[model samples]
Target: MMAAQVPGFYMKNESRRVKIPFIDSNSLVIIPVSVNGSEPINFLFDTGVKSNIFFSKTIADELGMQYTRKLNLVGADGQTVLSASVSPNNHFDLGEIEGIYQAALVLDEDFLELEKVIGIPIYGVVGHEFFKSNPVKIDYDNAEVTIYRSSALKWKPFGFRSMPMELIGNKPYVNTTIRQIEGPEIPAKLLIDTGANHGLLLNRETTDEIVLPPLTLETDLGRSLGGDLFGLVGRVRRVEMQGLKFRGVITSYPDQTEFSDVIIETGRQGSIGAELLNRIKIIFDYPRERVLLKKGAKFSEQFDYDMSGLMIRVLSAENKRFYVSQVRENSPASLQGVQLYDEIVAINKVPAYFWELADITNLFRSEEGRVITLEILRGTGTEEEAPEKLRISFVLKKQL
Candidate 1:
């Protein structure tokens, strides 16, 4: 994407810095944005995407937005392509900052189904456009984003480590090293993706050194623009970024069969997502092509994966209702008789309404062999008969 063609935002007034509070949902940042002066709607703050995109066309239709053209959006897997309409000259109000005559892509259908995945209403994604004209600081500890004017900002290194960044296709990329269990450190060029939720993603086909671990688990990685992405989950010995070293990092390797047709950039290994990024404070200086990082509250925390082997989805965020969307075969949840579509009514004797989605996920990824009780509502909701209510307990164990 060309710099001139990229959509950009401008500061509304003489403010040198603008602070925007965000909601951190499962390692993803959700911010409130108003379109064409409409009420604030939740939008994902992503660095991996080139242009702003609306997951559904409903919002655009409601705002009486007109389509200037149609675009074909390809998924990361490279096979799934969806058509989207481009609404040009739209006004975007991000509190203190505003974008006039901005372009946004609106999908005909909500292909990602992000609400069910993230347990919130995610109408769209705001990407490169937000960072093009300013330096953005992401404070994971405080759940806030601060945008600073390039001219008014002062450089204060302090304890922060500065590393060079490559701005390619309107996205940020950084260089890092990965060490396998029995091999030399492999240098990798990874995209700094704030949109992805996983810790580390490595494309095995990128190089001979980037191979899968001995033990791996076949799992549903996440949803893409196309559909659900299936992949293998494993662990690498360590990942080194500059002088910072992270040991036993949880890694993801997407199935090659699905990515066979995908075209990756030269020397681009994979991406580093929010899972690892949440452990540090980051300042993205796009103008200078450098990123400053400092250790955060979770810097020393060990990396972990979901030990319960159950993928839970939010049925209703307001009602605090959740259900098992997928259960891994031969896993703890399956072994304990946790069936698919089983509504989670309570956990550890507490009502589901009392627990947040993040709280439940944190418990699932807690210590191994940790036993937890679940109050499940089973059976179809049809009028044939009342749903069966049962109690099941399961021990969470590491799969990969």
Candidate 2:
């Protein structure tokens, strides 16, 4: 059922919408947007957030936005909370879509700086408030997002399964089943968070019925408003959705203590993020209380992760070098003597300066058992003085 009217945004034709190009960086959707005629900025097109948020205080202050007061925000991660100021009257444009946000939060810290970890610029985030007015389509295959007025949506497409969703605090939650190897199917409620990068994230408590895979590895999932999210990564034997069974799906379970009280109150098992949603065409129909899904080309592709046991980050774009942000103990990279803060000058003889962070990360995920030769520079003293360069070879092996 369509609401009487969606506030905030209006369409010129009401029947046609335009597709905006987006960068799918490290599984996060970064869309270009502008606020109050400011230069275009990248905002995370996150379905998990409730309100529009500008993460940079500098940006907020420069805009001359008035703040009502400060409030503490608890995140879905359950562990992190942010103290932010509530500002009103924010007008933003996303291609042909434009809207006025009566109130938006601005964090004191440049949460957008987190984008640097992935080598991108994400100034803010647009969430439920932006989508509430119209139907939105995310075509991951073509890396484009399309906005449709309620009238333009067909509502139902062939070969798609529709499931009712419960809107909790402006985020969508769905009840689904995850099959265990020996026990009955585990019924769980999960959030549809395009902002999250993982395929499946279950609170540690939800895995009692479903046994954990034989192989699991300690990994740093990502950052949350609270802190860095660290967890054990593994695979679920099967996840059945709409009569379709996805086997050997990669999954993560964060510590129970990390989640906030509100998340626990909602009894949310975990979240289904872009990693899984990208395998299927998904429609988030909040007003109708339903979500639709159709299989995508990558539906059958194997779930993969970085096999090098090394988490790398771009240290300097001008220098074209990457620094080891983290090294998993006992992993291939660890076994090969890769250490934290080690600069990567080249990979397999190709200068690291010539490769983008995404491509370099992909190279590390190449076929398991493949040999990767990394040229490393140790130490962080004066850069003018040449540092020691060492060649270390490691075989790409699955950690979990």
Candidate 3:
């Protein structure tokens, strides 16, 4: 579907650029946005999607927004379709900038469950609508997004590499090369997906040259609106674009059966997500059909995977309580008796509440052979019976 013809304007006519701060949670960008004069709400700023999507129908209803039509929304897995109502002619206020007569899709059900997964209240996602009319620069180190007016801004190439991008179906795709552990360099067309948290994703069905590495770990890649996406995690020898290279990059290979049915853009092989993008400062110049990139502060940091093998979720609205949502079999966490639904009370004697979800995730990805201690409360606590509290310690190990 085409993106809505929503034009965004600055609050002040003389303003040429506006900086909007964002929260980098799990490598995903979250920004505060107010819709139709409502209070500021947390929204995911995603380049992977074309439309603004509201997961809560109640929020739209409370704002007294009118639905103009019904739309069928497809999940990332391609098979699951959900019903949605399109609310047209809505106003959006993104701090210093505002868009009038914007279109938004309100889903009938809260299928993503992003709040539990990200440990933050993410109401929806805003994508092409906000990016189509401007040159948006993402400063990863500063945690801010600078939106420049296409008409007023002058392009400069100072220390930045410019790469041509293809605008297809309201999404941006770029060409690059990937070197697998055992093969020659393979040409690839990857989507610039800021919404995805992983470093890279390769669809093995895309080409014969794109093969899984010799070593791979079977794991749950992530959740799509359809359901849990199972995949393999491995490392590529190198991935290079425009003379910039990243070595030993972690890559995800979603099962072909899970994504094959989905109609992808022509010649699209995979996607470059935020985990890798976070290592560089990026400018999405959609108006000119190009992307500008420069090295970021953490450019030289090595890519790491989760060594704990525990998928955690926030069980409280405040994002303080943590629980083990999934435990990979035969991994360190599972081997150490970390089971699903185990409420993590403390880590290394430090209260789990004192740690943010990002901090915990980073700790698990810190390094292999690192020792971790956890005190967890398992089972339900009844009036007469109390839940069992146990301490489990494990050494992190690299599975792949």
Off by over 4 Å in 2: 1-7, 74-81, 181-184, 258-260, 316-321, 383-386
TM-score of 2: 0.91
Query: What does candidate 2's lDDT look like per residue over 1-400, in tens digits?
Result: 2332334655544557767788987667788877777778888989898878888888878877789999987654664567899997777777677765547789987643555466666778888886775667777887887777666656576877887788998998988888754456788889889988788887756446646666778888877665677778888877766666677778987765645455667778788888788887777777788887778888898888889999888776556668899999988999989999999888999988778787887788779989999999897557687677899999998776
Q: What order do candidates take by TM-score, descending?
A: 3, 1, 2
Q: What is the TM-score of each candidate against the true structure?
A: 0.94, 0.91, 0.95
Instruction: Report the C-alpha displacement of residue 288, candidate 3, in angstroms.
Output: 0.7
Which lDDT tens digits does candidate 1 get at residues 1-400?
Answer: 2433445777777578888899998778899889988999899999988889888797789987789888887765676788999988788898887777788899988888888788888999988988877889899999999888767445746888888999988899999989987656789999999989999998777677877789889899988677677889999998888788888889998866455434254458888999999999898899888888999999899998899989988899878899999899999989989999999999999999998888888999998989989999999868988899999999999887
Model 3 TM-score?
0.95
- Identify the superior model by TM-score, candidate 1 or candidate 2: 1
Weakest ten-residue segment in model 3 by summed lDDT: 1-10
**Considering summed lDDT, which 10 consecutive residues are worst modelled in model 2?**
1-10
Q: Which consecutive 10 residues in model 1 have the weakest lDDT in total?
A: 257-266
Counting clashing residue pairs in each candidate, in order, gives 0, 4, 0
